[model samples]
Target: MNNLFDLHLQIGSRRARQHIQDTPLWQLKQFTRKKKVPDLSSLEKFERSRKRFERKDRLLAIASLSRFAKLDIGREKRKGLPEVILAEGKLATDVAKITQAMLKRTGRAVVSRLTGSQVKAVRSIIGKEAKIEYFSRSRMMVVKSHSYTPRQSGGRVGILTAGTSDIPVAEEAEVIAREMGCETRSFFDVGVAGIHRLFEPVRDLLKWEADVILVVAGREGALPTVVAGIVDVPVIGVPTSRSYGFGERGLSALAAMLQSCSLGMAVVNIDGGVGAGAVAALVANRVGEYRTRVA
Candidate 1:
């Protein structure tokens, strides 16, 4: 029979790289010399013993990941996104226990909404050797970068914001998109207060050929509609707070954005940066896949 890995038009199983094993002649020779044992022609029994050892090892690995400290390690394979830990209500000691167990099982852990006190508590429990980061503006703490390197799944998604105050929301979206393995570009501090700046930078953003646009704005919320009118790609609108007086803390912006006149536009909840990034990532991935198929 031809070798499965042969590239010279060899017909083999459906799997090109099937796991094939050669006889363990060297191992048998060493065993015989070291133990004064006789060489055997009983190949069937030797094969059975080797396969038994291999099966035991595989089962052990699976059991290690199945119920390691109440963590579902199999989730890492089933869901493209890693399991996340919320630090909002759990005790620091319990969080540490959970995190360390997860790290042992999966080698990566993310805890969101990490406060100063909780950060201190987690550090104390982890004994100061753990690597964790605090995203100050987002009020989140992340154990950045998992064990396996994540691939870039989506093409570039252009990010835009109405004003400087909207940067926090924009940053949150950027973080989530990057975490989702999508290429991102941002045009910040371009608001309708100076329509000239908005039009010009937005024109530049369009020139870059974005797969999708995440337009984050506060107050009036007219930026997303205007942006959608100009771009052919899908526009995702995220309305934030930081607006004064009648803005009612982004409620007005949310209302305005939802009532947008432009077509092919979608709006997430108020200050829902994660929601916006999830939608953008999906669109960006689809566009990338479609372009690849066409090319």
Candidate 2:
């Protein structure tokens, strides 16, 4: 198998050199001293620096990939979320290999939309290397290294689903939020059809000081608006493809969510549990920071 990281050092070093060459006029003296370059004409020096800078700006690091997939290893540092493999359409073997590579590098990997066969393949490929947790409802898998420990304190996310049909999506959000260093509470089957069911869960979440809430629904998609109206925290709406006919395949639900009257409500794509989870995590993180400052 071709190695993805094989070109990492080579590319990084080359870029670093090019960056030095691009150093501005004021820093050209230091750059020359560092490189031990002999004296050159002022025009030559300026031209060389400009070309170097341009090259450096245009340079792109070689993709980090094994054979079939490119890995974003630095996403966690840059975006607060590691690259998660979406295994819906890929070959099972390819998923295994990519997930294994990620696990080896990060000591943890999340694979969503996994088929049963893909899950088995991943487990077989990464055998004994990590602890795997599978959520059948969500078709998601989480592989965690034994030594990995997250900070004890972080934000809180409340995940609510309109009906049992939406639990799969809600669970996906729950897993992603928890993995992103947020405490999560889940409430299911609380659609607006029966508004009373939402009260207790909402109260509990408020009492627990949840920083953000994720509301998953289908059909009219009114749950998010209701939740948003009640909570001061940010509310992320996830529209699931749970209904057929007028709001068939979640299109209507998505539209309803987008047109919500609630001020703090945000909507994700149909069945976009991951996106909703990510947004909720970011909001919760900010809330946590604010709380820390206040205290």
C-alpha local distance difference test of each model: 0.70, 0.82
Best by TM-score: 2
Every model's TM-score: 0.68, 0.78
What tens-digit string does per-residue lDDT give for candidate 1 at 1-295? 2332241123244342122234354554454456554544443454565577666654344323334235555553544455566777876766777766666666566666666777777667655445666677766555533444655775668899998888878877776676667889998888888878887767777787788899999888889998899889999999998687886789999999888899999999888876687678767877777777888
lDDT of 2 by residue, 1-295 (tens): 0221232224347654455344555465555556555573553554576676655543432246666787776677656776779999999999998888887778888999999899889989888888999999999899878887764337899999999999999988888888888899999998888899999999999999998889999998999998999898888999999999986999998999999999998899999998888888878877877787889
Off by over 4 Å in 2: 1-63, 151-153
Error of 1 at 42 (Å): 30
The backbone clash count of each candidate, in order, is 0, 0
The 10 consecutive residues of candidate 1 with the worst lDDT sum are 1-10
